[model samples]
Target: MVEIKDFKASDCNALWNINRNAFRKSLKKESYEEFKNITENSIGKVIFLENEIIGAIFLKSQSEVGTFKVEKFFICPKYQNRGLGYFILTHLPEEDTSIKKIELDIDESSLKAKKFCEKMKKEI
Candidate 1:
């Protein structure tokens, strides 16, 4: 099962490690800075599978209404095919009934991520 909880500063390095493996050499130094910025925010959460941190998401409210924007969301490469990404995508709405809309930016260069986004649209 996957669980969501507050992301603590202590988890930054661990998150970096996961990011490293997921993106490999494609990751830049700015990604770490961005992670720090997001982790310090009141929003965002760490995803855990059986007590192991496998992913994290950064969220920001788009309005006073029920819209939310997912600034960053990812699952560790090692944990990807186990359906954890799908779980997170589904769990977001299940956890928040007030969220009438959700949005996220996906890199068009990544066919895999684009496909995942398409799949999420179908499921949602």
Candidate 2:
């Protein structure tokens, strides 16, 4: 069973591990560090299964863009393809009532991610 909840400061280590394992070569340590820092003040969610973190997504308010930017979204390889991505994306609005739209930049190599967004009615 997977549970989605607000990220806690104590979960930094687990979040780091999830991010590292999920985007190994495509991302660097600095990216994770930046994520940690941003999550300190931004809105985000963490995915957990029996107390172990399996994925996470961060959203930052971008007034200039007129939407919430999905700063990061990652799922451990073992937890992929289970509809968790869709679940997480759909639940973002529940966190912040002020956010009207969610925007993200998916890597061209991440076809699955692009498809997921498209399925959710989000365009590139």
Per-candidate Cα RMSD to the true structure, in Å, reads: 2.4, 3.2
Return the TM-score for each candidate structure.
0.81, 0.75
lDDT (Cα, tens digit) per residue for candidate 1, span 16-107: 88866766644244467776777676367789989999988777888668777776677898788778877776777677666666776664
- Relative to the unseen true structure, what is the Cα RMSD of model 2? 3.2
lDDT of each: 0.74, 0.74
| Residue-by-residue lDDT tens digits, candidate 2, 1-124 | 7677888888888888877777665534456668678778677788888887888888888876548888778899898888778777776666556667887775554566566656666632
Worst 10 residues of 2 by lDDT: 24-33
C-alpha displacement of 60 in model 2, angstroms?
A: 0.4
